[model samples]
Target: MKLFRQVFLSIAAMLAVQGASAADARLPVVASFSILGDIVANIGGDRIVVTTLVGPDQDAHVFQPAPDHIKSVARARLVVVNGLGFEGWMERVTQSANYRGDIVVASQGIAVRDRVEEEHDHDSHDGHDHHHGKNDPHAWQNPANIVIYTQNIVAALSKLDPAGAALYRKNGDAYIASLNELDRWAIQQFAQFPPAKRKVITSHDAFEYFGAHYQVRFLAPQGVSTESEPSAKEVAGLIRQIRKEKIRAVFIENMSSPKLLQQISKEAGVTLGGKLYADALSQADGPAPTYLKLMRYNIGQLLAQMKLN
Candidate 1:
């Protein structure tokens, strides 16, 4: 009888250890950039451990993956990326790391706006041709597209950790509701401006999605990628266009240099509209620390620049 009791106690200890191990484990997730990292955190909450490769105010357009990032991706149960060709180096990094985990494209199913369509939309009133790329990967600029992002994130997280599915869905639903509200708010707010007054200049052509949704026309001296420089002729044309259009303000992006934009503003005789967050979020205490705050802050800054507020 004593021997039997010993064996039972040993089994109970093993069970306890197993339970503790299970309780201590959390889902590991890796996101390509800061904006997507925030969205994943919102859905995952404390149920997952998230690592962001490109952090706040960091430019993913020219991000270089570190060894630490490879290590993180190697061990992560799931990897999240902004697909629309946004993370140009992500595939190579994952391949180099031999990351075998599931990769979820957060922007999946979000209607991709190619550069040709973007140029057509921007210059619809005119017959000017724009030398642009084939794809514009900044879909998150539109709050409506964020709905698709939240859904994709929730689905991916739920699939990876079914036990935490309910919590992820709840968080995702709440966040998406906020996005919907933001969409409505932006529509109403931007409606205050007439089409003629909705034009502005930004550092890069990152706001095509935002412009499509908000009826605001964004003109940029540089192409979609900040890594590329605008030629002298392009700059001259932009200056002429700004002067002709009476574009009141030219804004600098959070992740781009203000020198070129400042130069454009000076030569174009326009005010420097406050810095806008395009590719990444700002520091913790800055105007656009969070994704939601980023959208609101951008609209507010632009509206204030137009004296519409």
Candidate 2:
């Protein structure tokens, strides 16, 4: 009985050591927001563990990092950001955390779109401070751009974890395939609607890439950044434009305040369309939990409303 007990104890100790070693093998990665978190998770699979500073349904525009976020960055082996001046606080957070890891700019290789200053400047009144950068940061709206994002992520992950390079590339290729399919479907869906009926209004200008790619036009009261609040004059002007164009596809973003859009819809004599996932993803139980589902849901909502237009 004593010999049997000793053998069992030795076996248990070996198993515990193996388990801890396996746990230690997982690379710690941090992403700026939930959308990127999901993408990184897909690429990393079981090889890396990911933490997101900005969670689902939270706006990254005005995200204030807490102590936990600082700790997350400090411990991360790799950090990823959208990098079109999207997360203005990211530099501050990384500085505070004193993170020394490699930082990956997910949108690094994509063709950037400059924010049309004249269009926004005309709408914004005096004393209105525009907070967004010169270029639009919502590149994930275009799946083609996400292809670039996926490639960057794969390259970053593989560099950090040479052993998992094959797996990361495999996952990235599969994701890019899905993105291509999504792009094709989006093109077909938008092609069914006439150009005149393709205009839409939302809480913010987060869909310019989507608009440009799919030939749909999106007008918003607020600028690219949700932090930029429109003046009464700007809101009135948008209301007038909505009326002039007879645009009925007015929608609110998941991460933005609906007060402005609600007011616009009521004053414009048009019913408010359903919520659209713009900068952030919805909760796991919601319609846009995944990146793929988010685009599909937004497209469905837009089409349903554009049919009325």
Candidate 3:
């Protein structure tokens, strides 16, 4: 009986040690927003635990950090952010949190474009301003941009947890392949539409990357940034342009309030392409809950609304 008790105690002790080692192996990562968190979750898998600074469907453009967010940041082993001035509130939060982890800027390798004059002005925005998103904080609008985001995440994770480097690389390669497949698939699906009818009217100027990549036109009331709202004059002008160009399907952005766009649509006699995932992901079980689902939802909506007439 004495020997059996000792044996049982030995087994329990070993189990406790094993649990501690497993816990140590897992990284505690913090992402600035939901989309970044999802990307981290995909590549990190079981190797890392990710926490999103901004919850689902929350606009990172206007996000303000809370006490809990600071605590999350301070606890993180690595911090991943969209950068390109998308999360204006993050720097202050990180400073307050006094975090010492490596900060990963996900947009490092993306090719950025300038915003249009009517919807944006060079002097109107500077670094660390949401308006700086004039270059399109909606980089995920084009899947190819996500390749760079994945690469940054992989590099940062590898640096923070070298043991999991191989897994991160392998996962990133697989995800990139899937993105490439989606890109080709999008091209093929869009080929069904005529070129003259390829033009689109979105609530904001958020789809230029998608337009450029897929050979479609994205006409917008606001410029390339969802952070900006147009004046009534601008709306009137856009309405006139929509009629003049015979634009089809004005889309409502997932992150922006749809009131202005809906009013414009009413006056213009154009259908509102409901709920596009622009600057953020939707809450799960909603439309565009995931990146894959977001793309599919947007494309499906566009297809349903777009007409050759």
Candidate 4:
């Protein structure tokens, strides 16, 4: 009985040591939002543990980080964020959290376009201020932009965990290939539409990058951020423009308020084009759970809605 008890204790010690070592092997990362979290997970695979701040179907535009978010940041090995003023609150939160981790701006290499704010220049916004002259932060809306984001993620992860460099590279390369495939597919689908009919209306200006890349023109009542509301004059002008241009599809974004857009659709007398996953993605069982799925779902919605005469 004594010998058997000794063996059981030895086995338990060995298992505990193994668990500790396994825990130490993982690089803990904190992503400012869900989309970035998903991309990090794709590259990190099983080598890293990622904590997302803003979850799926959540808006990062007006996100107020909780007290726990500070603790998450402080404990992270790396912090990933979609820069370009997208997460205006992130810097302040990280500073307060005293996060001493390597910060990676995923949208580093992409050429940021100026957000057009003429529509909301005079409107009273509720929580946050989203002015148009600022740089648009929704680069992930474009797959080409995501190529840069993935490269940044892989580089950041490799720098943090040198032993997992090969895995990160392989995973990043595979994701880029998939992104390229989606790009080609989108190009072909958009090719079938005439320039005039390819116009779209989304809740906010998040899809500007998508429009720029795919040759579709997107009009929005709100600015880049969902915090801003369009004035009555802007709505009237948009209604007139839609009537004049014969625009077909108007979409509601997952992150923005549907009330305003719904009103716009009713006033404009156009069918509400299905919901587009803009700033954030859907739940796991929904159409857009991953970054790839988000883009495909948005594209599918655009194609289906634009096809309506």
The candidate that achieves the highest lDDT relative to the unseen native structure: 2
Poorest 10 consecutive residues by lDDT, candidate 1: 116-125
In TM-score terms, which candidate is top? 2
lDDT tens digits, residue span 132-183, model 1: 4577899999989989999999999898889999999999999999999999
lDDT, each prediction: 0.87, 0.91, 0.80, 0.88
Backbone clash tally (model 1): 0
**Of candidates 2 and 1, the better by TM-score:** 2
Full candidate order by TM-score, most accurate first = 2, 4, 1, 3
Ranking by lDDT: 2, 4, 1, 3
Tell me how far the alpha carbon of residue 88 in candidate 4 is from the true structure, in angstroms, after superposition.
0.5
Give the lowest summed-lDDT range of ten residues in model 3.
120-129
- The reply for model 2, stretches above 4 Å from the true place, is 1-17, 117-133
Name the candidate, 2 or 3, with the larger lDDT value.
2
* Model 4 CA RMSD to the hidden true structure, in angstroms: 4.5
TM-score of 4: 0.91
Q: Per-residue lDDT tens digits of candidate 2, residues 1-309?
A: 999999999999999999999888899999999999999999999998899999999999999899999999999999999999999999999999998999999999899997753233334456353444479999999999999999999999999889999999999999999999999998999889999999899998899899989999888998889999888877887888788889999999999999989988999999999999998899999999989999999999999999999
RMSD of candidates 1 onward, in order? 5.7, 3.5, 5.3, 4.5
Give a tens-digit lDDT track for model 3, residues 155-207: 98988788999999999999889888888889898899887778777767777
Could you tell me which residue pairs clash in candidate 4? none
Candidate 1 ranges with C-alpha deviation above 4 Å: 1-24, 117-126, 129-133
Candidate 4 lDDT over residue span 1-309, tens digit each:
999999999999999999999977799999989899999999999999999999999999899889999899988999999999889999888899897779999999889888755432233344243454778888998999999999999999999889999999999999999999999999999999988779888888888888889989888888777898778887887887777777879988887778987887888788787898988879999999999999888898899988884
